[model samples]
Target: SLIVKAISRLGPVARTGGVRGPHGVRSEGAFLSPLLALLLLLLLNWLHPHPKALKCYKTDSEASNLTLEGCSPDKISCVLHFRIDKSTGARHRGLSNCWNLNDKCGIADCLYTPHSRIEDHGSCCCRTDGCNLMENLRLVTSPPTATTMPSKGGSSQGNRNSTSKSSSNDSGSEGGLFAKGGSDQAASVLLFSLAPVLAICVTVVLGFFLYTRHRERRKSRSESVGLASYPVDNHPFPVGHLSSHIRLKERLATGKFGCVYIGEDAETDQRVAVKVFPPQERGSWLVEQELYSLPEMSHPNILCFIGADQCGQGPDLRLWLVTEYHPLGSAHDYLAGHTVSWIQLLDLAESLSRGLAFLHESSSEKPAIAHRDIKSRNVLIRSDLSCCIADLGLAKKFFQGESIGDVHPQVGTRRYMSPEVLEGAMSFYKDSFLRVDVYSLGLVLWEMLTRCTDAYGAEGVPAYRLPFEAETGSSNPSLSQMQAAVVIERRRPEFPAECQSHQGLSYLRETICCCWDHVPEARLTAACVAERCKALRRLPVSVAAEEARRRQQEEQLADQQAPAVDLQLPQAAVINEASAAASAEELRPLREAEDAV
Candidate 1:
């Protein structure tokens, strides 16, 4: 029928393009020959007898009455299986034919329903025809006993003998298959048995972690209670519960981390600077606290730490850092309104350098520290005109044999960045980090000098300007602008020529120049700069004394060079000589009278 349809579809094409022989004889049989052959082949397939397929009683579920069904031509073997639901005590039996005669036969777990758990399932498959029809399909809990039946083509007595031998061989194969299934069951059992143990171990570890965290929190609370009960002394300041004694006053300054406020200790009534950090700034608060809590950290040139505390909960939580307050505020603020005398400038510079040197010094209990953000705003001016370094949030502490390379990269104000730091080529050594601080300190010194009345002469002090503000035209310059000015252009803060006229100011200029040198190794150490400042402090007194002696020598030399007038004494000179001679004679008489008596 398909061949007839193909010929009918090509009837028009065959007629329009009919095949012609060399002698012009039209031949239509050539195209029809292939179609006729295909039709004959299909007819022969329908007439020929097919090989016999397996006959089996097949059903997916247990049926009260089952009918034998013929298997497909490809299926040569039969299979029968039964499953029992452990939860419901229901049973299911199924029979099907397989395409291959070597289909494996064994009782094992089987998946039946989609998205359903596998209950107590057991399935058995076999290769023989009608094997599913045997009585062996009965529900026997133990491994199914292999059974054999006679083939249709053999004699009854001969088939019986062959069935006996095949049954024996199948029994051994079934035993080995059951043995593997037993091993698999043992492995599953073992996994389930250890589940509780693994769960217990994980729970214990998590509980221990929680317990340790709880204990640390409890200890912190206890310390806070102790601090509130007693007056703050030399011990480490507790970092909790501050509202009880500390009263916050006016806000002083605000920064990226938090705000600084003026506060007072209720019991002592001593004013202090309270730095309030938000919850997100907890890390910075802790870092500053650790820096201040170091042993022997208290110094005249360093900010004095009082105590720290926390208040509120969650997003509303605020961390408080209390320290000694200076009414004069930061050096930057002070320099904005007032110019310092030469002596005052020297004093501020020396104190700042001393604080930095102390921070860099290491002790048995404390490590050397590098104040990464060393700027005028971070240096506070005390009422006594001295300066103390503050705001150690970016400070890096180095223990013995520790490398400075572990610090975060390029953190600080852009305007005061060093050449190496600006170019991002900073070396990761102790000295290299310290030099970065020195370069920033040099810019701060320039800030102080620019506002020094003595350095600028009668024109008085220049308006307070940040380092490189003139070149960048912005107080807060971008990183690229700073890099261009400090690294590419090699520009630094300007030094007035008038400052060089004074010996002390000239030495200060040299010190500042050395500190801000492009070469990190060439910069002066904090200690060295401090010593130079001390020398400048004493310079004025020594310079004045030397001037006095120089003037005295000049006057005596002028007297000696004066021309002499001999043998021509004035009347006033002669009269003075006679009166001196008379007075001497009377004194000589009085002396002789006294000796005789």
Candidate 2:
């Protein structure tokens, strides 16, 4: 029938171009013969051996009715075997499964014996799907007598042994498929019937994929600006192996998107940090993956991404990102109840600035990405106490040749927000976004500098306080409160005047002030801050403090001796001199230390 349909469909096309043979016969038959043969070969290829195993219910007196798949095709009967408890004489629940057929088994209904202790001889066997259902428990409980069993008579034996006999010839035949010869024709017809639908579905899916890919390429080319397009990772991860391999030991932190946990690798037993996000936080998860997948993104000062996974499902879905773990936790926790030396402060500042600088860098494979949320809590520390920037959840990417236009200006910690961000007047330009990060860096540097041991001279480092905590008097300030403090009042985090004693602290304090400058244009870049940190470490701070003090006294004496009042700014000069004298007084201990050196 398939061949006839194929020939009839091709008949119209062949007839349109048909030529007559010498004896009034069409030469189209010549082409039709080869087409028919090809169709036959295709048909043969389509016929696959159907899965011949029968599915049967299985239970050992359990509440579950387990469906057994891929049982041996020869095991055509479903068996229910139950025994009376030896002492109680009470019939227990039956054990039901696909039957194991043997030579002594009945052609249709076979009884082995009235009763047997070991072989479950009284069990009931029937050739039907789920025939072992508990509704038929009475069949197993009451065994048939020997007289009621079908005897293997000569006629029955002869009929079963006959080579030419068909299964249909026996009235009690189970209708089980025995061999490939029995079902080849049926299997071939079934496959050929369903082939076109399967082929169309596959072709439609493949063509849709190709069309979407081509359209994306054309759109990207149209937006080209002499720079390579950003590379996107497919981001397939080992979801199956996530829960099986990594054992989460303790929860480290929790936030808007998800919770972080300390997980240990089952194989290597190495500690790893696992950030698990809920299904709704997939956007943040993708952002983290994209930032980490960028070229040259792996730095000593950035959190390392090991892998990602989809653990559990539905309401319990968790988007997990695994990374190398550090024991010191975050800068907030590290600086709590402790103080750091000037050198340790420099180390933390430099490494953090370097990481932020790299994040704002544009490469062939990546656009400039800004970590919009920069805070002491988001900054993690390694064993050496150097800082690495973490948590790219709120990060934004700036692809080349695109207008940033307007943005969601109100972001990041309220205290760390820049004047422009707090006022909601920030420009949606690339440099503007990066400067926000630098401003937050400044606040964080101030947070760390507040804990610097030598900054306050004899007073020691004051207990750690977040930026603007002194004025606001709250760890978490409201948006309006911050806007008033940072934008309207132009108030920044204050430092003790005595911090000017150490030259390095003075330089660092200057850098922090520059970072959080009221004017965004005046703020230093992350790279510049990193360089300043390195220079502070190299400078002889005590000697510099001494030279600054000597220069201050000389200026004071020179101003006292030289003629004044040339300009009407004498009061301004007097005020500046008075502040200089205060700085001079503040640096006396630093000068003594320099002298001692």
Candidate 3:
């Protein structure tokens, strides 16, 4: 203060010294020396100005990307977009609406980065072009005294104020730039995280599509094969060509393999039977074709194969098998002729034995042949009344010397199945034919002996009663005194008046019963049965008795078919003949009941 005063007073003296001479200059030097030193100290103080820290605390209105365009001509309008420290919500408003909104200045384009330091307030002001706006805009509490801030050079002070603000802003900008970069980095990280999952999802979808297409192709191929719904003629094979030049006459029968039509060849005009298989059932037909080609099928009792028709791409086509056509049908149909004589039954059994023996034994060129599914349906008759074995579809030809017991465990018709087969004890692949087919032959003999009596046809008859039912009754007896008519059950057959004199039928009865033993080893072999029948032929049996039975049976059947003419009744003669047949039919039910037990 003293130095400034001294200098102020020296101003007058310095002007006088220039007017007066070197003597006035020497007097003013004493007073100016202290002032000169003080002036030097003050100049250094100005060089290092006291640090002015102006904390521009941001209000809600100062943090937006605002512009001056929205302001009225008299006021500056600007917005602030920011959040307060520890506040739950953000603040946005026009800065122009603030108290003491400085008319000389405005702020524009200000924004805070997300997650910024809310403690540090920031603001910017845009000045009108001609106006010295925002100059001395500090939050000053008190106006400085004349000595505290020199009144001279007012614009220089304004310049000093602006320089301080510019420095502060430059420091704040470094933090804002860092915050902006961090926000961008977070977004990029999120995108990278999902890339692998999306790639895996796309790969899985493509793989499933390709797999489904492959399965569709395979299913289409299978549909062309053996679907049950397809018709016989609609098969992929050419039917017209397969049946070309074949002339059908009468229908023999319809079967699972298809229709069997009796026909004649157009070229040779020879009578033949055409067995056709339904398209979907071609598997059985294919098996038959292989059986026909077997080398051991030369037996006279077996049906002969003439030719075969194979048409289509795979083994699953319709088959038309050609063979010699006979006027007579299956044994079941032939046996429908009222009654079969014991002599006729013995002859049928002998023919069957010959055929079965040929199949069971091995020859030099071929192996043991098994007709696995032997049944009454497969036995055919000719016009000459000779029996033939047909339908060899289930036949299996094994190597010579191979045992039938070692074959697959289960196969063949259920009724004729041996006890070993029922128990699954026999393996055709392990045991010889004598152990397997011989047992079946016994059952076949039993069937021929019993025939299909009406009593048994009703579904619940024991097999043992069949023999006693065949007896001719010569007397009427009480029911309570009767025993099992078939003595094969280890029970005695009660004597009937009609059958008490059947002494000549004892050998044939013994032969049929021996074949039906429970144990396979105990059963008679087909060969043994055939030999016994041959022996029986040598016995001196009256032909007149057999002829009489046959004639009587035919007349009974004719009477049942249509009404008889009115004439004198031959009651006694008719009664004598019918007594035996009536007992046989009636005993069939009792025999079946015992077998079930």
Candidate maximizing TM-score: 1
lDDT for each residue of candidate 3 in 355-422, tens digit (9 for 90 to 100): 77776677687576777766666778766555778887767777756544334645665444455665
Tens digit per residue, CA lDDT, model 1, 413-479:
8888898887889878777888899999999999998887656543556677888989999878999
lDDT against the true structure, per candidate, is: 0.68, 0.68, 0.49
- Candidate 2 structure lDDT: 0.68
Candidate 1 colliding pairs: none
- lDDT string for model 2 (1-597, tens) is 644443343345433535679998867555445444444434444553343555566764462455655456445556555555666656544556664332223333422344453432245555545555545544333553222222122253452334124333432433332222123234444555565664665556556766887988976754341112223233122433566789899999999889999998887788889999988888788778667767767788899777776679789887788877899999999999678876788899999999999889898866898899999999999999888989998888888998774557787777788888887888878999999999999989988888876666444567778888887888889988988888888888788775665556776888899998888899999988887777666553543455455545545555763345344257545655665565556556544543442
RMSD (CA, Å), each prediction: 26.1, 26.5, 33.4
Better of 1 and 3 by TM-score: 1
Query: For residue 2, what is the lDDT in candidate 3?
Result: 31
Of 2 and 3, the candidate ranking higher by TM-score: 2
- Alpha-carbon runs more than 4 Å astray in model 2: 1-240, 405-407, 540-597
Task: Give the poorly placed runs of model 1, Cα more than 4 Å off.
Answer: 1-232, 235-239, 403-406, 542-597
TM-score (all chains, Cα) for each model: 0.54, 0.53, 0.43
Flag the better candidate by lDDT, 2 or 3. 2
